[model samples]
Target: MAHLAACAPLGACTTKQNASLRSQSARVVPRAHHADGETQAASPALTRRGALAAGIAAASLVLDAQESGAVGFKKELKDKRRGRTRIPEEEYTKELQDGVKYVDLEEGTGEVVKKGTKVTAHYDAFFRGIDASSSRQARFLNENINLPEPYDFAAGSEIRISKSKELPLPPQALTIGVIGMKPGGKRMLLVPADPWGYGDKGYAEVPPGATIEVLIELLSIGEA
Candidate 1:
């Protein structure tokens, strides 16, 4: 009689356990109904795919907007360049090769820039233009004077502010422009709208066909 009483409670417990498992499974597994009234468990794989597709679409839209904005900005720059006139060559003190011109503001007395020397300097750039009367003015574009560190590059290589470090060390215009410059010297260069000055492709905020007026202050010279 004792064993029978124990067996009866065990059977009741098993029944209760089965009932609880069924209730939990029903709550956890969602069902989907088809048009023909066939019911099936909802697919977690399908839910994940839907979410992935939505994320990709949102990302594509953001990319498209960014591309559109860049294109619009480039067009605006081109239009602005078309309306501007070049500054007269006589305004500069001396002319270097390839039509690059410079006027010495303050001559440096420290070290001369030579081949393979790394030059460090702070610079301010402007877009130069003239009016119908041939009077020229510089419109400020960018500057690195307030920055804690100055630009350091090879003396005879190309340097574009908008480009990465992969570009050649400095532009020929700059190389020739800084030929006699020493530490603490300042010079203003009028770079022509050629390959030396971003060329027809232009640089960030510098319009196409724009002549760049750069005021460079020589800070230091070191071996590369």
Candidate 2:
């Protein structure tokens, strides 16, 4: 196994290691799609809030998967030269629209992530540089760099809001980006630096007007 680590502000540091992929044992909930592009889970037995809480509880299962040595809950892609897992990349340049862009690296076989679905995923967020030739290799902002510890959160849930107009809103782009993903799926999201990402003021590491690219891998989806 190989471990990758990085230091960032807010005490956000992650260590990722390569491991085999395996399925987690959990109940599956039926998923439904809405006209607005949001997917919803069918859970009449539980209230909306209850369903949300149940979704969050599913995150614990990710720990079990990790303990089993399945870092991203998926197969490892090895880079022979560096002796590390290789990240799948887009073949061509993708233009960003609607303040975001995403590409699926691996399609998951599990249930689709809908509203109120608790999702566990691993992500690496990078700062898109002003120079096109150097953007892909630019510096990262926060969260996991290449380490694959799963981040657990509910889709469409409001987390924190930035009170300052200069700062970007929290959880907006990320929540919307992960919707419809299935367990084991890997996706790359490009978020514009406006209301969707670190805004004019940015953060301690992120600069103003810098775009962010996030690579996300869905580890598990909790039963509704």
lDDT of each: 0.64, 0.57
Model 2: residues with Cα > 4 Å off, grouped in runs: 1-97, 129-149, 160-171
| lDDT for each residue of candidate 1 in 68-141, tens digit (9 for 90 to 100) | 99889778755543434444567796886677888888887876888677887765555654111100112222
Indicate which candidate wins on lDDT. Answer: 1
Q: Where does candidate 1 stray beyond 4 Å?
A: 1-89, 129-148, 160-172
For model 2, residues 187-217, the per-residue Cα lDDT tens digits are: 7777777766667776545677777666666
lDDT of 2: 0.57
Q: Which candidate is the best by TM-score?
A: 1
Name the 10 consecutive residues with the lowest summed lDDT in model 2: 17-26
Error of 2 at 63 (Å): 41
